[model samples]
Target chain A: MSITREEVLKMAELARLEFSEEELDGFTAQFQGILDYIEQLRQVDVEGVEPTSHVSLSADFDPRMFREDEARESLPVEEALGGAPDPAAGHFRVPKVL
Target chain B: MSLRRIEEADPALGAFLTCDPGRVLERAERVDRDVKERPLPLAGVPVAVKDNICTRGLRTTCGSRMLEQYVPPYSATAIERLEAAGAVVVGKVNCDEFAMGSSTENSALQVTRNPYDLDRVPGGSSGGSAVAVAAGMAALALGSETGGSVRQPASFCNVVGLKPTYGRISRYGLVAFASSLDCIAPLGNSPRDIALLLGRIAGRDPLDSTSAPAPVPDYVAELDRPPGRLRLGVPKEYFGQGLDPEVKAAVEAGIRNAGKLGCDVVEVSLPHTRFAIADYYIIAPAEASSNLARYDGVKYGFRAEAPEDLMDMYRRTRTLGFGPEVRRRIMIGTYALSSGYYDAYYGRAMKVRTLIRRDYERAFEKVDALLGPVSPTAAFRIGEKASDPLSMYLSDIYTVTANLAGIPAVSVPCGFTAGGLPIGMQILGNLFQELPLLRLAQAYIREFPVAPPPLRV
Candidate 1:
């Protein structure tokens, strides 16, 4: 259950998050403790057990519960982009992918 | 008057992120005008909203700098319903960043103190919501529960908090931490107020498919008919080690009071109770990791100043925007759902979750509801468990099971510690059974009422 600093950094990279050197050291220790604590779940004999990923979704999966997939008015572009950190020409402007 | 109280006391209490007097007055006036036409359930009731629930024009921060200035385009279904039913939203309150922590200390914006003891932490991430009601800043408040957010804070502040049956209330505008576990719950000074608010906000929302299509009952009317001669089970595991003696004693006394109401209080074992925290940690964070992936610097929210590329922007924006605990959860989730470890971690945890749910199902078949302590102990000092995340996580042990099982549960003021800290007794009900659950809460409150915490405010 031990997670090394490299593994921590790798996980951070996957999560699209970064950490400082000090934070990494501190979080790595805290993270390892949490992992170790949750590790107790391994002991449960889960043979033939159905994973309850969602309580309502798993038990009650009626398609009728959802709204009809009808096209309707959406938020106007101005309202939609009102909170955008960076917007340009009715689009969320990001750095060039190329 | 809630606005004036917020202005006067919220400075010291640190309960709100934003409280615009002009908007509050406008909404109140509108409610006043509307009540003339017909009776409203929550007519003119002042409510403080958690920052995570979207309010059309007001900023929805989720207590994270990532969304510090982010204003949503539309309000949540619950908010719209609250307004339509004549509830005046006092303001948006603070919470743990992305509703992650057990204490309000994780709020990047402000530290909300418990109304009972100013130096103690308001159990969170619904600390501000609880503080609002306890200090009379608002009559009721909306707090979202991913783990023990609302109820834990209510327990700390001596108010009442309800985590309704999952999908019993719509999650349309609630900022998702763990989609399956997140519930936009209510906190109030009394169970009667909670019932009133629940009636207004509970029902199917076309916008939120997860919202139950089940008929909404008159919760306030149901309260008139007390839950008579009920079978109340006291889970033995919740009473075991790590429970503070004072809390344990107080809750036992509360169970005894239930017996006075003709309830059959018996000991039951939720064998998988010990594994709840483990299962919850894995599942909640795994879902959180996915839900929060939308916060990349692309659309809205805080963006990094200068990035060489999109990848750099994503990493830097999240790194700078999220707090330490949030980053830790995201990392844990990423690692758990990672290629080589998914089955061992997330998969195993989900199966374990079934065991936890089954434990509740079996107990409910024998007893109408389960009574227990909401938190392991009363509110601790501000920095006591902040440094140790594991210790903080342990405090939520008694609360997470109800959420994991998707059942309704409420925290009512049971008693107080000698140190004058407030303790709460948690009552959990079967799926979609909020009516009887609330009746039990109302009956308990009617029989043994704990005076509201005497705050200097």
Candidate 2:
């Protein structure tokens, strides 16, 4: 019915995240609150009503999609790094590892 | 200079986390030179882009340290179009990290304050964009909506936010939140401005495969069309429980204002509104967790220093990089997708999602358009729900269904709470019905434009 700390741990494992002690305590309470709110749905009789997915129910026309199958524009190496915080001759530079 | 004004003002205003003052001013000058003889429509307009959009020369942080220094190599298609239309990029505005929350309060970078009241929060994801435009820092802004990111913030900030029907605007360069549910939209101080900007941006794009081939309607001209037979639907679900009395009253007043302009208002029930939030959590996260898997510090983003192995690098980088909300959704998504839980979670949610769409279908048959509150409450104080995640997620209750349905929706300033904080009434049109929605919003603005949003320090 509601999210449990165990559920949070299970979720964290599935998500591959490691939480701090503070975070674990904080999120458990938070996620539980959301689950409780969603439980409000259980009160409504949505059994017979068709569930709504999109604002528009029409499923008529689908757009025609196609691509040239070619790389149209490839920026030169210099232009590619123009936005990088730190850039070398042709590539982005990161902090030294070894 | 105007550039300094935004940075200087936005810091306290919380509109911009990073202001590219030098670049924005320089780019404005380039617009002058590059477009001298032939003036572009948006020539010289300084615009703020939500951090989630990738701008080629600026760091595309998406309000997270995960992309703290990641400057995208190429411009997002929307940004490219805006620049081509002669708008200079002022800088990136802060947002809910990865646009996962309703209140911009979720952004780890900096929370954008509502221009109306400094202590109150701006609505999320596109909060900074709305604040930037509302505060006069920029004439226009770019925001994306998976749910209410664009519209809700625009309501809080009293700007106009337009989320075109899915694929009305190219999604080629937006950082993905929920792919099927997301869109790059426009925000402006007024409905007319939204129409003008939409004219320049909406259309088929070769790069975005999802873009519809339908001719991009001339939004500006369409704004003037008279409302002769406009049948607007008022969904009872949106105006119900948890909605502040002041906000509900304001929305009804807004409907009356629209009625005065010859728009016919009718009550329509989106019967499955009850199941939307539950359905959204399942579907959106399932999509997002999969989309975000690329950020494992392997291909092109921040990587953490780990003890030896590749798993260590992936684990440490993701653990350190993403914020709590981002991690939460990713986990919810992953669990829903895991082998054992896939059918119960992801599969069932997909069925519900389909049913939710059907609810809208049935409603639209009785009404031409739908109206509702963009958000349940007016702007809340900073940290109001920061500690309570469920309450925060509920903040998007009114706005999420449209995303699930993939329809065009817009949030325009309708009225204000007693405290003068703006409340927006949302307009949802059938898929690809952006032109009519803009027209209706414009009509409402013409009849009763809320007073300019207060600019508090």
Error of 1 at B166 (Å): 0.2
Error of 2 at B168 (Å): 0.6
Interface RMSD, every prediction, one decimal place: 1.3, 5.0
RMSD of 2: 3.4
In candidate 2, what are the lDDT values of residues B1-457, reduced to their tens digit?
4576775686688778767667777788889997877869988888889999988768888888888888787888888998899988888889989988888877877767887899888888788898888888888999999978899889888889998888788888899888878899899977788888888888788887777767888888778987567888898888778988999999988887777777788888887777778778877887889888877665466778643665566667788889878888887787668787675666666666666677788888888788888888998999888877767777888888888888888898888887888889888988788888888887778778677644775
Residue-by-residue lDDT tens digits, candidate 1, B1-457:
8988888898889999999999889878888888999998789899999999999999999999999999999999999999988899989998999999988899999898887788998889999999999999999999999898999999999999999989988999999899989999999988899999999999988988788888899999878796888999999999999999999999999999989998988999999999999888999999999999999987889999989998999989998999988988888899899999999999999899889988998999999999999998999999999889989988999999889988999999999998889999999999888889889899889999976546756
Best by DockQ: 1
State TM-scores per candidate.
0.98, 0.91
TM-score, predicted candidate 1 vs. hidden true structure: 0.98
Q: After superposition, how far is residue B6 of candidate 1 from its true place, in Å?
A: 1.2
- In candidate 1, position A18 carries an lDDT of 83
Give the clashing residue pairs of candidate 1, or none: none
